[model samples]
Target: MDFRWWRRSFFGAFLSWVFFFLRFSCSDKACAAPEYTFVKEATSAPPVIFYDYIIIGGGTAGCPLAATLSHGGATVLVLERGGSPYTNPNITNIGNFASVLLDRSPTSPAQPFTSEDGVYNARARILGGGSAVNAGFYTRASTHYIKKVGWNQKMVKQAYEWVEQVVAFQPPLMEWESAFRDGLLEVGVLPNNGFTYDHLYGTKIGGTIFDKEGHRHTAADLLQYANPRKITVYLHAIVHKILFRHIPGTARPQAYGVIYKDAYGVRHLAYLKRNSKNEIILTAGAIGSPQLLMLSGIGPGYHLRTHGIQVVVNQPLVGQGMADNPMNVLLIPSPLPVEVSLVQVVGITKFNTFIEGASGLSFVYPLARRLAKRFRLFLNQSDYEPFKVPPEDMARAVDTVNAVVNRTLRAGIILEKITGPASTGHLELRNLNPDDTPFVTFNYFKEPEDLRKCIEGMRTVISVVNSKAFSKFRYKNMPIEALINLMLTLPINNRPRHATAAISLEQFCIDTVMSIWHYHGGCQVGRVVDKEYRVLGVDSLRVVDGSTFYRTPGTNPQATVMMLGRYVGKRILQERYLSRRSKHKN
Candidate 1:
C-alpha cells in the first residue's frame, strides 16, 4: 500500500468539504444578515444610564425577554458579553455545526471548558446563546415537566407558539436521519409520533432551528419582535457585578444597577430607572448566573469572604445542586457514505431516558485526527496542521481559516442522556474576572440511581444499533465494526471505559460520560430563586435562564428556555398591569 496515495486521499476528501461549503454553500443571503440598528457595540454605551429593565446576557432567553419587555413599552437594555451570531458562518450554516465547537480561538462563539469529571463541554459565548451553538434540536418540555415547574400550561403553549413562529421548523429528514428514526421504532422505543414538537414517550421527530436549506435560525432572530426604539442591545458588554443598594425601609439588598466592562476594558454602569417595578434580570446561563451571584457578594458568606468579595446576601445554595445530563454515545461507522445532518430524530423512552442522534457530522480536526490515527495513516503530528503541511487542494491559510475542512468520517451516533440526573455538583468563583470560567464539578454518576439509569439507556441504544432498520447502513463483518468495538473500551486521560458488553455497563457509563450541554441548576428554583425566578434575599433581581431549572425540559432545553423568556416576559407585563389597576382602585 502506497502511503502517499493514502495521504492524497485525506487531502482530497477534506478539501472537497471546504471548497463547496465556503464557495457554493454560503450564498450572499446566507452569508450576511441586515444589521439591527438597536444592536450596538458595548463601547458606544453611555458611562451611566438607566432603563426600565436591565437584562444581563442577550442569549436564548435574554433575547426573547428583551423583545417581550420592549414590545410592552418598557425600556430594556440587554448586555451580552459575546459577539453577534448573525454573520458568523460557523453559526449561521447548519452544515458547519461542529466547526464553532472545534474552534478553540479566544473569540470563538462556543467557549470550551472541561469539567472536573474530565468531560469536554462548551458554554455559549454568542448573542443568541446556546441556540446559536447547539445541535438545533427543538422540543418542548413535557406537560408533566411544565406543571411541576408551576408554569401555567395555557401560557406555556402560547409562549412556545411564539418561539416556534420565529426559530422552530420541521426539518426535512436526510437518509441518515430517516434511518435513525426507523431504527428507534424498530427497537420498540414506542409509537412513532412523527415530526411533532410534543414531548411524548416515543420515537418522534422534533423541530430544528435548521431549515431545509441548512441555514440556522438562532434566538437573535427573535429580536425582530423587539421594539427597536425601546430595546437597546450591547454586544461584548461583560457584567462583572450586580450593583445593590439599601432601600430606606427594606432589609433586603435591592439590586439597583450593574457594573460592566466593555470589550476594550472600559467601565460602564447601567441602572434601573428607580421605579418600584423596575428590575435587574440575570438571564446569564447556569454557570454564568451562579458565578456572577458569587462575584456580586450574593453567595455563601464564607466563600465570598475567601474571595475578598463583601457578602451582600449569605445565600448558601446559590451555586449548589448544579446538574448536567450525562450523555453516552455509540459511534457506528457506515459502509455507505452518509449525508451531513444535525439533531432531528429522537427516541423518548418511558424509563426516564431521552435518546437523540446525529449523523455525518464532520467534527473539524479532533475527530478527524482520531479517525486518521485509527486508520494508522503514515503522517507526523505536523502533517495534520494545515499551516505546516496544507492539504494539497487548499491554501496554507486554511489552518487559521474558520471553516470545517475535515470530513474523514461517514458515521452515525446513537446517544442517550437521562432526564433527571440524581447526581449534582456546585459552581464556585475561581476568580473575580468575568471572562475566566469558574471552578465547577458536576459529579456525574455519583448517585447509584443515575448510573443505573445510564446503563438502561445504553442498553436501549444497543438495541437500536442491532435493529433491522439500521442494518442496511452498516456491513456487520466490516473491519470498522471491530475497530470501533476496540475503541469503545479504550481509556482517555487514564479513565478506562469498560468493554461494551452487558455486565460492564456501569463502568462504561462512568468512564464514557460527556455533557449534552443540558446542564442546569446552580441558582435553583426554590433555593436561589423563587417560583417567579426572583433571586432570594435580593429585591428587584431575577434569574430567568437554565440556572433556575430543577430538571431539563423536553428532549432538549433550548425550546423550553426560549419559551420561558416569552412566558416570563408576558407574566411580568401582566403583573405590572394588574398592580396599576389595584393602585387606581385604592
Candidate 2:
C-alpha cells in the first residue's frame, strides 16, 4: 500500500476546494468575519493574568458568548483545547466532511471515541466545536421548547438573528437535495413548508452554515461581532482544572481561576479580578463540561476519592442524564453521479422523529478500506449497505466528488433520528486525565418509547425510499438484515445474519443504533445548574452550553446552542454592570 498514494488520493479533492477559502479578509460581510484582533495562540499568554471572565472551551457557544461579553469594555479569556478553525482547511472546506470525521489523529477537529455501549462517536476538538464538523443544518428551537426552557422569548429571537446575520445562509438546493425534498413530501411526510428557519413540523429546507460557494461558516464566525480589543482567545490551551476555594462568608466553594496548559505543556493560571462579581464559565459542551467538573473535584464525593481528588462539592448530578439522538440510516448505492451535499432538506414528523439526508459521499470507500485495516475491523462490504459504513463498522464515508475520479460506486444516505431520545445515561471519568475522553453511555433504545419511535421512523423511511422520486436509486431490494449486521457490526452467536432471518426490523432498531452527533445533557439546568445556568453549589461558576438542555432544541441544536451563548452573554452584561454600579456607590 503506497502511503503517498493514499495521501494524494485523500487530499486531492480537498486541495481543489482551497480556492474557495484563499482570500480571508473578515471585512467582507459575505465572508462573515470582522477585523478581529482578539484571537491569540495559547503559547502567547503570560504566566498569570486576572480578567473579568474566564471561559473554558472556545466552541459553538463559547465564541458567541465571548463576543457578547466583550460589550461595555469587559475582558474575556477563552481557553480552547483545540487549534483555531480559521486556517485549518479541514475545518473550512465542505468537501473534507467525511475525511475530517474519519480522521483519527490526536489533533483532528473531530475527535473520535468509543462509548461504553460499544458505539463509536466523535466530539469537536476545534474552536468552532461541533459547528466546525457537523452537517451545518441550522434550525431554531420549537416555540414550545423555548418556553419550556424558561428563556425570555424576545431575547431568544434577537440572539438567533444576531448569529444568523453572520453564519446562517439560505442554502441553494442541489439536484440531490431538491429530489430529497420532493421524496419527503411524496411520502406524505408533511405540508411542503418551503424554506424557513423556524422548527416547523413538515418537509422544508433549513438554513445552513455553508455558503453558495460551499465554504463552511462555523460558529467561530460569530466572533466577528466581538469587540476584539476586549477578548483574547487562546487555542490549544487545555484547562487542567478549575481552581476553587472557600470564601470567608460564602455558603459553598467559589471558582476563582483555572490552571491550563498550552501546547508546549507549560502551565498558566487565569483568574477573575478581585470582588467585582467576575466568574468562570464552562461552555465545554456536554462531554467536556462534566469531565472538567469531575477533574476539578466538583463531582460525586466517592468517585473523586477513588482518584485521590479532594472533593470540593459533592454534586451527585455532575455527570447525569447524558443523552444522544439515535440515528438509523439506509444507503442508496447509485451508479449515476450525484451532487455532494449535507443536511439541507429535512422531514420533521409528528412522531418525534426527523428525517434528513446527504448525497454523493463516494470518497469514503477507499479511505474506509484503510480505516478498516487500521482499526483491525473487517471491511466486508458484502453485508454493507453503501458508501458510509456504519460507525459500528469502524468507518465513515467522506463526501468527495466521485465523478472527478471516474468512480461509479457513488452513494446517498437517507437517515432518520429520534428527537427526544428519552432514554439517557451517565458519564464517568476513565482516569484523571483531561486529555483522554471520559466514559459516556447514551444507552440507546433502553426505554421502550425510544424503540417505538424508531419503528415509526423506519416505517416513514420505507415510504420515502419507495416514493416515485427515489425509484431510480433503488437498484434492488437490499436486505434489512445485512444493513443491520453491517451497520451494527454485531457479531453472531454462531449465526450469520445474511444466511438467515435471525433479526427482525424491531430488533434491528435496537442493534443498529448510532449517534447523530446531537448528544447533550450531563450538567442539565435544574439538576446541575440553576435557571440562570449558574452552577448550583458554587459561586462565580456557570455552565452555559448544550449540557444545560434537558432536550435538544428542534431538529438541530447548533443554532439554539449558539443563541444560548449570546442570550446568556447579554444577561450577564445586564446583571454584572448593575452590581458594579452598586458597589461603586458604596
Candidate 3:
C-alpha cells in the first residue's frame, strides 16, 4: 500500500491551509485599524454639513459620545473650538501639566480668564477638553452618585470598562507619592483603598490617564472607537449658536442646526437631518454649555433680551447655579529634590475635604512671579482688602505664592481642596457676544460652614506634614505656625492679638482661594435638563457634560464625565433602535 504518498499529500494540504490563513489574517488586521479623516479648517468643509447627530465641543464627553454614536453607524459631526490635541505637546505630555494651564495663547487648550470675583480660572478648549489639560487623576463616580442619578448600575459598569480600556492607566507609585500615602494614613485618613479605579472612602490611590513613560492618554484617544468613515471632526470650529424653530402652537422650541466659525473667521452651518430622529448634543463643560444656551436665547428671558438675543425658551436656570471646588495650597519646601508625580494619592476626610499632593519641578515660575507682584499690590493698601482685590487678582496671588514656593525650593506642595463647598455661585452674560467669556463668580467662603471646613483641611495638611513619615524631608526653618503667619498677613487695627490673628487667617483663605477646575452645576438635572439629559423646553437637544451634573461628586469629575458620556451614548442608541422598531410595527 502507498501509505507514504497519502501522508505526503495530507501534509501538503495542511501547509497550503496555514499559508492561506496567515495571508487573510494580516489583511483583516489592516482592515480593522482605524483611519481618521479630520477637517482642520472650516473653509475646507462643504458649504453646509449634515449629520444624524451634531455634537458641540469635542471634549471629554463629546469625544466619547461621538465615537460611540459613529461606531454604531450614525453619521456624527464634532465641532471643537481649539486645535487638535495630537499636535499639542502641552496636552500630550504628562510633564507639561502646569505648562498647559500656564499657556495664555488664544488657542491654548486651557483658556484662562478672570471671574467677576477676581479669581483666575480656565476652561478647556481642545478636542479632548479638560482631560487634555487637567492633572490626569481618574476615578469613577461613587455608587451613591450612580443611584442618585438614576443610572442603570450594570450599564454604568460597562461604560467605565469601555473608557478604561483605552485611556486609563495604573500610575507607578514613586517615592514622593509613596510617602504621601503613608502620611495620609498616619494622620488617620485611614483604611487605605489601594490601587483601584473605583471611588472609595479615606486614603486611596486611583487610576490616572498618565502612563508609565509619562505620556498622557486623554479622551481624545477614545476617538479610536469611532468609525472614521461615519464621523467628521472639525477642529477650530467655534459654535456660535444653536438655531431654533418654534412651531405655531407648540410650547417647545426645536433646535434644528448650529452656526459656527472656523479658524479663518469663516462661518458655517451644521444641521440635523430632516424628518429623522436626529439630535444636537452640547458637551461644552460646565461654563461653556450654559454660556452657549444663553447665547441661543435659552437663559433668563430678561438677561437675553438685555443682550439683544431674542427669547426662545426663557429657562431662567440655564446659568444660574454655577459652583466650583475651592482649593488652597500649603507649600512644603524640601531641601532635596522630590520625585515628580500628579494626584497619585488622595486623602478623603470626613469634612468633605480632599487632600492631594504633587512634587516636581515648578513649571509656571514666570506667571507666578507676575502673580506675586499682584499679591504685593493687594497687600499694600487698605483699599485693597480681600473682597476689594477682585477674585482673579487673588487667584493669581494664591497661584503665584504656590508657584514661587515650588520654584524657589526643591519641594513638594500639599494641596487641600474643599470638594463640596456649601456656598454656590452663578454665571452671567458679560455681553451678548458669543466670543466673549461669561462672567463667573465662585463666591468662595461666602458660607461660614465652607470656611470652617477649609480651615480644618488646612490644619489636616499641617498635621500630615508634621507627621513622622515626612520628618526626614521637612524643612527645619519652616515652622508650621510661622509659615501660616507669613502667608496670612493682614493689617492689625486696634484689636487683641488673638482676634487679629484669627481674622487674618480667615482673610487669607478668602483672598487666596481658587477654583481647582472641578466646576459643575449650570445645566443641572431638575434645572436645565431632565433625567434623560434632554433640555426641558427644547426638542432634539441634549446636554451631556459636567454642566449636567446635579452636584459635584466627591472626587475628580473627569472619570464620572466619561462614564456619563458612555452611558448617554448607549441610551441614545437604544432609543434610536426602539424608534425604528416602532416605525416598522406601524
lDDT of 3 by residue, 153-192 (tens): 9999999999988778777777777888899999999889
Alpha-carbon local distance difference test for all models: 0.78, 0.77, 0.73
TM-scores for all candidates: the values are: 0.87, 0.87, 0.85
Model 1 C-alpha lDDT per residue in residues 83-167, reported as the tens digit of each score: 9987788778755654675566787788877777776677899999999887777899989998888899999999999998877
lDDT for model 3, please. 0.73
lDDT of 1 at 175: 80
State the displacement of the C-alpha of residue 291, model 3, in Å, after optimal TM-score superposition: 0.8
Comparing 2 and 3 by TM-score, which wins? 2
- Each prediction's RMSD to truth: 8.0, 6.3, 15.5
Residue pairs with colliding backbones in model 1 are none
Compose the digit string of candidate 2's lDDT tens values, residues 1-586. 4574464343332212111121122323475333457777889999999899999999999999999998857788999999877777766766555567657678988887767876657789998898998778899999999888889999999999999888887866777777778889998888998999999889998988877666788888888888877889998999989999988876888899999999999999998988647889999999999999999988899998998898989999999999999877765555456766667789999989899877765544566455334323324444343434455523322222122224333556777889898999999999977878899988888899988998888878777767778766543334333334434443211112332222455766666566677899999988999999999888999999999888889899999999999999999999988987998999
Tell me the TM-score of model 2.
0.87
Query: Which candidate number would show the highest TM-score if scored against the true structure?
Result: 1
RMSD (CA, Å), candidate 1 to true, equals: 8.0
**Model 2: lowest-lDDT 10 consecutive positions:** 15-24
Worst 10 residues of 3 by lDDT: 16-25
